[model samples]
Target: MKKLIAIIPLLALCACWYSFTLKPYPDIDTVFVDSFANETDRFELPSAITEGLIGELHSGSILKLATRERAHSVLSGTVTHFGSEAYTYTAGEEPLDFRVTVRARVRFERAGADSPFWDYTVEGFATYPMDESTKSESQAIDEAVSMLISRIMDRLRTG
Candidate 1:
Protein backbone atom coordinates (compact mmCIF):
# COMPACT_ATOMS: atom_id res chain seq x y z
CA MET A 1 0.00 0.00 0.00
CA LYS A 2 2.80 2.38 0.90
CA LYS A 3 4.62 1.52 -2.38
CA LEU A 4 1.56 2.49 -4.39
CA ILE A 5 1.45 5.93 -2.81
CA ALA A 6 5.14 6.46 -3.40
CA ILE A 7 4.90 5.39 -7.03
CA ILE A 8 1.97 7.71 -7.59
CA PRO A 9 3.94 10.76 -6.53
CA LEU A 10 6.93 9.64 -8.58
CA LEU A 11 4.78 9.34 -11.67
CA ALA A 12 3.27 12.72 -11.01
CA LEU A 13 6.67 14.31 -10.74
CA CYS A 14 7.74 12.72 -14.03
CA ALA A 15 4.62 14.01 -15.75
CA CYS A 16 5.15 17.51 -14.40
CA TRP A 17 8.73 17.63 -15.58
CA TYR A 18 7.77 16.35 -18.99
CA SER A 19 5.09 18.98 -19.31
CA PHE A 20 7.17 21.91 -18.10
CA THR A 21 10.60 21.44 -19.58
CA LEU A 22 11.88 20.27 -22.94
CA LYS A 23 13.55 16.91 -22.97
CA PRO A 24 17.19 16.59 -23.89
CA TYR A 25 17.67 15.76 -27.55
CA PRO A 26 19.81 12.89 -28.66
CA ASP A 27 22.08 13.51 -31.64
CA ILE A 28 20.12 12.98 -34.78
CA ASP A 29 21.59 10.83 -37.53
CA THR A 30 19.82 11.46 -40.83
CA VAL A 31 19.07 14.83 -42.37
CA PHE A 32 17.70 15.76 -45.76
CA VAL A 33 18.78 18.98 -47.42
CA ASP A 34 16.68 19.63 -50.45
CA SER A 35 17.72 21.46 -53.59
CA PHE A 36 17.74 25.24 -53.75
CA ALA A 37 14.38 26.59 -54.72
CA ASN A 38 13.19 29.97 -55.95
CA GLU A 39 16.58 30.69 -57.44
CA THR A 40 16.97 33.80 -59.57
CA ASP A 41 18.77 34.35 -62.87
CA ARG A 42 21.65 36.52 -61.80
CA PHE A 43 24.59 35.11 -59.79
CA GLU A 44 22.99 31.71 -59.60
CA LEU A 45 24.62 28.69 -57.98
CA PRO A 46 24.23 25.12 -59.11
CA SER A 47 21.77 22.58 -57.71
CA ALA A 48 24.90 21.03 -56.25
CA ILE A 49 24.40 22.92 -53.02
CA THR A 50 22.47 19.85 -51.96
CA GLU A 51 25.58 17.74 -52.30
CA GLY A 52 27.66 20.27 -50.39
CA LEU A 53 25.08 20.24 -47.61
CA ILE A 54 25.16 16.48 -47.37
CA GLY A 55 28.95 16.47 -47.23
CA GLU A 56 28.85 18.98 -44.37
CA LEU A 57 26.34 16.86 -42.50
CA HIS A 58 28.77 13.94 -42.71
CA SER A 59 30.87 15.49 -39.98
CA GLY A 60 30.12 14.54 -36.36
CA SER A 61 28.34 11.23 -36.99
CA ILE A 62 25.48 12.61 -39.04
CA LEU A 63 24.21 10.88 -42.17
CA LYS A 64 22.60 12.35 -45.26
CA LEU A 65 19.28 11.00 -46.42
CA ALA A 66 18.30 10.19 -49.97
CA THR A 67 14.60 10.37 -49.14
CA ARG A 68 12.78 12.71 -46.80
CA GLU A 69 10.60 10.01 -45.30
CA ARG A 70 13.61 8.10 -43.98
CA ALA A 71 15.38 10.97 -42.27
CA HIS A 72 15.18 11.88 -38.63
CA SER A 73 15.13 15.56 -39.61
CA VAL A 74 14.11 17.25 -42.81
CA LEU A 75 15.96 20.42 -43.77
CA SER A 76 13.94 21.91 -46.55
CA GLY A 77 14.61 25.44 -47.72
CA THR A 78 13.95 27.86 -50.50
CA VAL A 79 16.94 29.83 -51.69
CA THR A 80 14.62 32.83 -51.23
CA HIS A 81 17.45 34.70 -52.86
CA PHE A 82 21.21 34.64 -53.24
CA GLY A 83 22.38 38.19 -53.66
CA SER A 84 25.92 39.35 -54.19
CA GLU A 85 27.63 42.71 -54.44
CA ALA A 86 31.11 43.56 -55.58
CA TYR A 87 33.59 45.28 -53.26
CA THR A 88 37.20 46.29 -53.41
CA TYR A 89 39.52 43.74 -51.82
CA THR A 90 42.95 44.87 -50.71
CA ALA A 91 44.41 41.59 -49.54
CA GLY A 92 47.80 41.09 -51.23
CA GLU A 93 50.60 43.50 -51.86
CA GLU A 94 50.68 44.22 -55.58
CA PRO A 95 47.07 44.83 -56.68
CA LEU A 96 43.87 45.26 -54.76
CA ASP A 97 41.37 42.42 -55.17
CA PHE A 98 37.57 42.20 -55.55
CA ARG A 99 35.01 40.99 -53.06
CA VAL A 100 31.55 39.50 -53.24
CA THR A 101 28.89 39.66 -50.54
CA VAL A 102 26.57 36.69 -50.26
CA ARG A 103 23.39 36.18 -48.29
CA ALA A 104 20.79 33.43 -47.86
CA ARG A 105 18.01 32.36 -45.52
CA VAL A 106 18.20 28.81 -44.15
CA ARG A 107 15.18 27.25 -42.53
CA PHE A 108 15.62 24.14 -40.38
CA GLU A 109 13.44 21.89 -38.25
CA ARG A 110 13.23 18.52 -36.58
CA ALA A 111 10.84 16.08 -38.15
CA GLY A 112 8.55 15.48 -35.19
CA ALA A 113 9.01 18.48 -32.93
CA ASP A 114 5.90 20.55 -32.55
CA SER A 115 6.99 23.48 -30.39
CA PRO A 116 10.30 24.68 -31.84
CA PHE A 117 11.46 25.59 -35.35
CA TRP A 118 14.55 27.22 -36.82
CA ASP A 119 14.29 30.00 -39.37
CA TYR A 120 17.11 32.45 -39.92
CA THR A 121 19.38 34.11 -42.43
CA VAL A 122 23.15 33.69 -42.66
CA GLU A 123 25.25 36.19 -44.54
CA GLY A 124 28.92 36.29 -45.39
CA PHE A 125 31.31 37.95 -47.81
CA ALA A 126 34.36 36.50 -49.53
CA THR A 127 37.10 38.43 -51.25
CA TYR A 128 39.03 37.29 -54.29
CA PRO A 129 41.28 39.05 -56.68
CA MET A 130 40.34 39.44 -60.34
CA ASP A 131 43.04 36.94 -61.28
CA GLU A 132 42.34 34.45 -58.49
CA SER A 133 42.44 30.82 -59.54
CA THR A 134 39.16 29.01 -60.13
CA LYS A 135 39.97 26.43 -57.46
CA SER A 136 40.55 29.12 -54.83
CA GLU A 137 37.26 30.83 -55.54
CA SER A 138 35.30 27.59 -55.28
CA GLN A 139 37.01 26.59 -52.06
CA ALA A 140 36.32 29.98 -50.51
CA ILE A 141 32.60 29.83 -51.19
CA ASP A 142 32.40 26.25 -49.90
CA GLU A 143 33.96 27.24 -46.61
CA ALA A 144 31.51 30.08 -46.09
CA VAL A 145 28.40 27.98 -46.68
CA SER A 146 29.73 25.11 -44.58
CA MET A 147 30.33 27.50 -41.70
CA LEU A 148 26.79 28.79 -41.98
CA ILE A 149 25.32 25.29 -41.66
CA SER A 150 27.50 24.51 -38.66
CA ARG A 151 26.11 27.51 -36.85
CA ILE A 152 22.58 26.41 -37.67
CA MET A 153 23.22 22.93 -36.30
CA ASP A 154 24.70 24.33 -33.12
CA ARG A 155 21.62 26.46 -32.55
CA LEU A 156 19.26 23.56 -33.13
CA ARG A 157 21.21 21.26 -30.85
CA THR A 158 21.44 23.74 -27.99
CA GLY A 159 18.14 25.59 -28.35
Candidate 2:
Protein backbone atom coordinates (compact mmCIF):
# COMPACT_ATOMS: atom_id res chain seq x y z
CA MET A 1 0.00 0.00 0.00
CA LYS A 2 2.81 2.45 0.77
CA LYS A 3 4.61 1.66 -2.49
CA LEU A 4 1.38 2.12 -4.44
CA ILE A 5 0.86 5.53 -2.90
CA ALA A 6 4.41 6.60 -3.82
CA ILE A 7 3.89 5.45 -7.41
CA ILE A 8 0.69 7.42 -7.69
CA PRO A 9 2.44 10.72 -6.95
CA LEU A 10 5.23 9.94 -9.40
CA LEU A 11 2.73 9.01 -12.08
CA ALA A 12 0.76 12.19 -11.50
CA LEU A 13 3.91 14.26 -11.76
CA CYS A 14 4.87 12.55 -15.02
CA ALA A 15 1.45 13.25 -16.47
CA CYS A 16 1.74 16.89 -15.60
CA TRP A 17 5.18 17.13 -17.17
CA TYR A 18 3.95 15.44 -20.33
CA SER A 19 1.04 17.81 -20.72
CA PHE A 20 3.29 20.80 -20.25
CA THR A 21 5.61 19.69 -23.02
CA LEU A 22 2.83 19.00 -25.51
CA LYS A 23 3.23 22.16 -27.54
CA PRO A 24 2.69 22.56 -31.25
CA TYR A 25 4.90 24.36 -33.73
CA PRO A 26 4.71 28.10 -33.63
CA ASP A 27 3.28 30.24 -36.46
CA ILE A 28 2.29 27.25 -38.57
CA ASP A 29 -0.96 25.42 -38.88
CA THR A 30 -1.33 24.02 -42.37
CA VAL A 31 1.07 22.56 -44.92
CA PHE A 32 1.04 21.79 -48.61
CA VAL A 33 2.87 18.77 -49.94
CA ASP A 34 3.64 19.03 -53.59
CA SER A 35 3.75 16.06 -55.89
CA PHE A 36 7.33 14.96 -55.87
CA ALA A 37 9.24 14.86 -59.13
CA ASN A 38 10.54 11.46 -60.07
CA GLU A 39 13.96 11.44 -61.63
CA THR A 40 13.84 7.70 -62.02
CA ASP A 41 11.60 5.81 -64.39
CA ARG A 42 9.49 4.38 -61.60
CA PHE A 43 5.81 4.69 -62.44
CA GLU A 44 3.55 6.70 -60.13
CA LEU A 45 6.36 7.36 -57.67
CA PRO A 46 5.61 11.04 -57.55
CA SER A 47 2.01 10.42 -56.59
CA ALA A 48 3.06 7.86 -54.05
CA ILE A 49 5.42 10.29 -52.33
CA THR A 50 2.84 13.04 -52.23
CA GLU A 51 0.18 10.78 -50.79
CA GLY A 52 2.56 9.26 -48.28
CA LEU A 53 3.57 12.66 -46.94
CA ILE A 54 -0.01 13.84 -46.67
CA GLY A 55 -0.99 10.67 -44.83
CA GLU A 56 1.89 11.04 -42.44
CA LEU A 57 1.21 14.67 -41.62
CA HIS A 58 -2.45 13.97 -41.06
CA SER A 59 -1.74 10.99 -38.88
CA GLY A 60 0.76 12.97 -36.88
CA SER A 61 -2.13 15.29 -35.92
CA ILE A 62 0.17 18.27 -35.70
CA LEU A 63 -0.62 20.00 -38.98
CA LYS A 64 -3.62 20.39 -41.24
CA LEU A 65 -3.44 19.81 -44.97
CA ALA A 66 -3.92 22.83 -47.16
CA THR A 67 -3.77 23.91 -50.75
CA ARG A 68 -0.78 25.66 -52.26
CA GLU A 69 -2.37 29.09 -51.97
CA ARG A 70 -3.52 28.74 -48.36
CA ALA A 71 -0.65 26.87 -46.78
CA HIS A 72 1.61 28.39 -44.18
CA SER A 73 4.40 26.16 -45.40
CA VAL A 74 5.18 24.07 -48.44
CA LEU A 75 7.00 20.79 -48.87
CA SER A 76 8.43 19.78 -52.21
CA GLY A 77 10.90 17.19 -53.28
CA THR A 78 12.23 14.84 -55.91
CA VAL A 79 12.73 11.13 -55.78
CA THR A 80 16.32 11.05 -56.90
CA HIS A 81 17.07 7.34 -56.75
CA PHE A 82 15.66 3.94 -56.01
CA GLY A 83 17.28 0.56 -56.45
CA SER A 84 17.48 -2.96 -55.09
CA GLU A 85 20.43 -5.18 -54.28
CA ALA A 86 20.73 -8.87 -53.64
CA TYR A 87 21.76 -8.85 -50.01
CA THR A 88 21.84 -12.54 -49.17
CA TYR A 89 22.79 -15.47 -51.33
CA THR A 90 22.60 -19.17 -50.75
CA ALA A 91 25.74 -21.25 -50.50
CA GLY A 92 24.82 -22.67 -53.91
CA GLU A 93 25.17 -19.12 -55.32
CA GLU A 94 21.49 -18.44 -55.52
CA PRO A 95 19.87 -15.21 -54.46
CA LEU A 96 18.06 -15.49 -51.14
CA ASP A 97 17.19 -11.91 -50.15
CA PHE A 98 17.22 -8.35 -51.32
CA ARG A 99 17.61 -4.84 -49.93
CA VAL A 100 15.84 -1.87 -51.44
CA THR A 101 16.93 1.73 -50.98
CA VAL A 102 15.07 4.91 -51.80
CA ARG A 103 16.54 8.37 -51.82
CA ALA A 104 14.98 11.82 -52.12
CA ARG A 105 15.81 15.48 -51.77
CA VAL A 106 13.18 17.49 -49.89
CA ARG A 107 12.62 21.19 -49.33
CA PHE A 108 10.39 22.77 -46.71
CA GLU A 109 9.76 26.47 -46.86
CA ARG A 110 7.73 28.74 -44.68
CA ALA A 111 5.30 31.22 -46.09
CA GLY A 112 6.93 34.36 -47.53
CA ALA A 113 10.38 33.05 -46.64
CA ASP A 114 13.17 33.64 -49.12
CA SER A 115 14.94 30.38 -48.23
CA PRO A 116 13.78 26.98 -47.05
CA PHE A 117 14.07 26.20 -43.39
CA TRP A 118 14.69 22.53 -44.03
CA ASP A 119 16.35 21.16 -47.12
CA TYR A 120 17.86 17.73 -47.08
CA THR A 121 18.55 14.56 -48.97
CA VAL A 122 16.96 11.75 -47.02
CA GLU A 123 17.04 7.99 -47.62
CA GLY A 124 15.34 4.85 -46.39
CA PHE A 125 15.93 1.15 -47.01
CA ALA A 126 14.46 -2.20 -46.19
CA THR A 127 15.58 -5.82 -46.46
CA TYR A 128 13.42 -8.81 -47.16
CA PRO A 129 14.01 -12.50 -47.65
CA MET A 130 13.35 -14.19 -50.98
CA ASP A 131 10.94 -17.12 -51.00
CA GLU A 132 9.78 -17.94 -47.52
CA SER A 133 9.21 -14.36 -46.46
CA THR A 134 5.74 -12.95 -46.91
CA LYS A 135 7.11 -9.46 -47.56
CA SER A 136 6.98 -8.22 -51.15
CA GLU A 137 8.86 -5.51 -52.98
CA SER A 138 5.79 -3.30 -52.87
CA GLN A 139 5.56 -3.67 -49.13
CA ALA A 140 9.25 -2.89 -48.77
CA ILE A 141 8.79 0.28 -50.74
CA ASP A 142 5.89 1.31 -48.56
CA GLU A 143 7.96 0.71 -45.43
CA ALA A 144 10.82 2.79 -46.80
CA VAL A 145 8.45 5.61 -47.64
CA SER A 146 7.03 5.54 -44.14
CA MET A 147 10.54 5.76 -42.72
CA LEU A 148 11.41 8.67 -44.94
CA ILE A 149 8.25 10.51 -44.01
CA SER A 150 8.87 10.00 -40.32
CA ARG A 151 12.39 11.34 -40.65
CA ILE A 152 11.16 14.41 -42.47
CA MET A 153 8.59 15.15 -39.81
CA ASP A 154 11.16 14.68 -37.10
CA ARG A 155 13.42 17.20 -38.73
CA LEU A 156 10.62 19.71 -39.07
CA ARG A 157 9.48 19.31 -35.49
CA THR A 158 12.97 19.48 -34.05
CA GLY A 159 14.11 22.38 -36.18
Candidate 3:
Protein backbone atom coordinates (compact mmCIF):
# COMPACT_ATOMS: atom_id res chain seq x y z
CA MET A 1 0.00 0.00 0.00
CA LYS A 2 2.83 2.44 0.83
CA LYS A 3 4.58 1.76 -2.48
CA LEU A 4 1.33 2.32 -4.36
CA ILE A 5 0.82 5.67 -2.63
CA ALA A 6 4.37 6.80 -3.53
CA ILE A 7 3.90 5.68 -7.13
CA ILE A 8 0.69 7.68 -7.42
CA PRO A 9 2.44 10.87 -6.32
CA LEU A 10 5.25 10.22 -8.78
CA LEU A 11 2.79 9.72 -11.61
CA ALA A 12 1.00 12.90 -10.69
CA LEU A 13 4.28 14.82 -10.66
CA CYS A 14 5.18 13.46 -14.08
CA ALA A 15 1.84 14.49 -15.49
CA CYS A 16 2.19 18.02 -14.18
CA TRP A 17 5.73 18.31 -15.51
CA TYR A 18 4.70 17.02 -18.91
CA SER A 19 1.88 19.52 -19.13
CA PHE A 20 4.15 22.38 -18.10
CA THR A 21 6.73 21.49 -20.71
CA LEU A 22 4.28 21.08 -23.56
CA LYS A 23 4.71 23.55 -26.38
CA PRO A 24 1.84 25.42 -27.97
CA TYR A 25 2.76 24.76 -31.60
CA PRO A 26 3.10 21.03 -31.54
CA ASP A 27 1.17 20.73 -34.78
CA ILE A 28 3.32 23.19 -36.64
CA ASP A 29 5.97 21.24 -38.48
CA THR A 30 7.50 23.74 -40.86
CA VAL A 31 8.01 27.49 -41.15
CA PHE A 32 8.86 29.96 -43.88
CA VAL A 33 10.73 33.11 -42.96
CA ASP A 34 10.16 35.85 -45.47
CA SER A 35 12.58 38.61 -46.38
CA PHE A 36 11.97 41.47 -44.03
CA ALA A 37 10.70 44.79 -45.39
CA ASN A 38 13.20 47.54 -44.75
CA GLU A 39 11.72 50.90 -43.93
CA THR A 40 15.09 52.23 -42.82
CA ASP A 41 17.30 54.06 -45.25
CA ARG A 42 20.24 51.84 -44.41
CA PHE A 43 21.15 49.72 -47.43
CA GLU A 44 21.09 45.90 -47.16
CA LEU A 45 19.53 46.10 -43.70
CA PRO A 46 16.63 43.94 -44.71
CA SER A 47 18.75 41.21 -46.23
CA ALA A 48 21.09 41.13 -43.30
CA ILE A 49 18.25 40.91 -40.81
CA THR A 50 16.56 38.20 -42.82
CA GLU A 51 19.72 36.16 -43.06
CA GLY A 52 20.32 36.49 -39.36
CA LEU A 53 16.81 35.28 -38.56
CA ILE A 54 17.11 32.37 -40.99
CA GLY A 55 20.37 31.37 -39.37
CA GLU A 56 18.72 31.33 -35.95
CA LEU A 57 15.78 29.30 -37.17
CA HIS A 58 18.06 26.79 -38.84
CA SER A 59 20.19 26.41 -35.75
CA GLY A 60 17.25 25.99 -33.39
CA SER A 61 15.91 22.91 -35.23
CA ILE A 62 12.62 23.36 -33.42
CA LEU A 63 10.82 23.83 -36.75
CA LYS A 64 11.79 22.64 -40.16
CA LEU A 65 12.51 25.27 -42.79
CA ALA A 66 10.30 25.18 -45.84
CA THR A 67 9.35 27.17 -48.86
CA ARG A 68 6.38 29.48 -48.54
CA GLU A 69 4.08 27.12 -50.38
CA ARG A 70 5.00 24.18 -48.17
CA ALA A 71 5.13 25.91 -44.85
CA HIS A 72 2.77 25.36 -41.95
CA SER A 73 3.44 28.90 -40.79
CA VAL A 74 4.99 32.05 -42.23
CA LEU A 75 6.98 34.68 -40.44
CA SER A 76 7.21 38.19 -41.80
CA GLY A 77 8.73 41.29 -40.38
CA THR A 78 9.29 44.95 -41.20
CA VAL A 79 12.18 47.05 -40.03
CA THR A 80 10.50 50.18 -38.76
CA HIS A 81 13.59 52.08 -37.64
CA PHE A 82 17.32 51.81 -37.30
CA GLY A 83 19.82 54.39 -36.14
CA SER A 84 23.05 54.88 -34.28
CA GLU A 85 23.81 57.54 -31.68
CA ALA A 86 27.02 58.48 -29.96
CA TYR A 87 27.02 56.81 -26.59
CA THR A 88 30.31 57.76 -24.96
CA TYR A 89 33.08 60.29 -25.43
CA THR A 90 36.82 59.94 -25.13
CA ALA A 91 38.82 61.87 -22.61
CA GLY A 92 39.81 64.31 -25.37
CA GLU A 93 36.08 64.85 -26.18
CA GLU A 94 36.37 62.68 -29.25
CA PRO A 95 33.59 60.25 -30.00
CA LEU A 96 34.31 57.02 -28.12
CA ASP A 97 31.31 54.80 -28.78
CA PHE A 98 27.91 54.65 -30.35
CA ARG A 99 24.76 52.70 -29.63
CA VAL A 100 22.79 51.27 -32.51
CA THR A 101 19.10 50.50 -32.13
CA VAL A 102 16.70 48.70 -34.44
CA ARG A 103 12.99 48.25 -34.13
CA ALA A 104 10.74 45.92 -36.12
CA ARG A 105 7.22 44.64 -36.39
CA VAL A 106 7.04 40.87 -36.60
CA ARG A 107 4.14 38.59 -37.44
CA PHE A 108 4.01 34.84 -37.29
CA GLU A 109 0.84 33.29 -38.64
CA ARG A 110 -0.40 29.85 -39.38
CA ALA A 111 -1.16 29.05 -42.97
CA GLY A 112 -4.81 29.74 -43.77
CA ALA A 113 -5.50 30.82 -40.21
CA ASP A 114 -7.90 33.65 -39.57
CA SER A 115 -5.50 35.50 -37.25
CA PRO A 116 -1.79 35.62 -36.61
CA PHE A 117 -0.31 33.43 -33.93
CA TRP A 118 1.91 36.25 -32.83
CA ASP A 119 2.24 39.91 -33.81
CA TYR A 120 4.40 42.39 -32.04
CA THR A 121 7.11 44.99 -32.30
CA VAL A 122 10.53 44.14 -30.96
CA GLU A 123 13.58 46.37 -30.51
CA GLY A 124 17.25 45.63 -29.96
CA PHE A 125 20.37 47.64 -29.33
CA ALA A 126 24.13 47.27 -29.32
CA THR A 127 27.01 49.57 -28.41
CA TYR A 128 30.01 49.90 -30.65
CA PRO A 129 33.11 51.59 -29.30
CA MET A 130 34.73 54.01 -31.73
CA ASP A 131 38.29 53.13 -30.99
CA GLU A 132 41.14 51.23 -32.64
CA SER A 133 39.28 47.99 -31.92
CA THR A 134 35.90 49.39 -32.76
CA LYS A 135 33.38 47.22 -34.55
CA SER A 136 32.04 48.39 -37.89
CA GLU A 137 28.48 49.42 -38.56
CA SER A 138 27.67 46.01 -39.97
CA GLN A 139 28.86 44.31 -36.80
CA ALA A 140 26.72 46.54 -34.62
CA ILE A 141 23.76 45.83 -36.84
CA ASP A 142 24.41 42.11 -36.60
CA GLU A 143 24.46 42.29 -32.84
CA ALA A 144 21.17 44.14 -32.82
CA VAL A 145 19.71 41.60 -35.19
CA SER A 146 20.76 38.73 -32.98
CA MET A 147 19.25 40.42 -29.95
CA LEU A 148 15.98 40.91 -31.75
CA ILE A 149 15.94 37.31 -32.88
CA SER A 150 16.47 36.11 -29.34
CA ARG A 151 13.58 38.22 -28.09
CA ILE A 152 11.30 36.83 -30.75
CA MET A 153 12.23 33.25 -29.96
CA ASP A 154 11.67 33.79 -26.26
CA ARG A 155 8.21 35.16 -26.87
CA LEU A 156 7.35 32.34 -29.23
CA ARG A 157 8.49 29.63 -26.87
CA THR A 158 6.77 31.09 -23.83
CA GLY A 159 3.58 32.22 -25.47
CA lDDT of every candidate: 0.58, 0.83, 0.85
Sort order, lDDT high to low: 3, 2, 1
- Find the number of clashing residue pairs for candidate 1: 0
Better by TM-score, candidate 3 or 2 = 3
Superior candidate under TM-score, 1 versus 2: 2
Error of model 3, residue 97, in angstroms: 1.7
Ranking of models by TM-score: 3, 2, 1
Q: Residue by residue across 104-131, what tens digits does model 1's lDDT show?
A: 5766667776643577776544666556
Best by lDDT: 3
TM-score of each: 0.58, 0.78, 0.80
| Candidate 3 lowest-lDDT run of ten | 129-138
lDDT of 2: 0.83
* Total clashes in model 2, counting residue pairs 3 or more apart in sequence or in different chains: 0
Model 2 steric clash pairs: none
lDDT of candidate 1 vs native?
A: 0.58
lDDT of 2 by residue, 1-159 (tens): 999998999999999986775334567888898899999878666688788888888886467889989999898999999988898999998889888888899998887689997789999888777773789988888777778777877776766
- Stretches of model 3 off by over 4 angstroms after superposition: 1-14, 17-22, 90-94
**Tens digits of lDDT, candidate 3, 60-147:** 6577789999999988899999989888987988888889999999999998788999899999899888762868867888889889
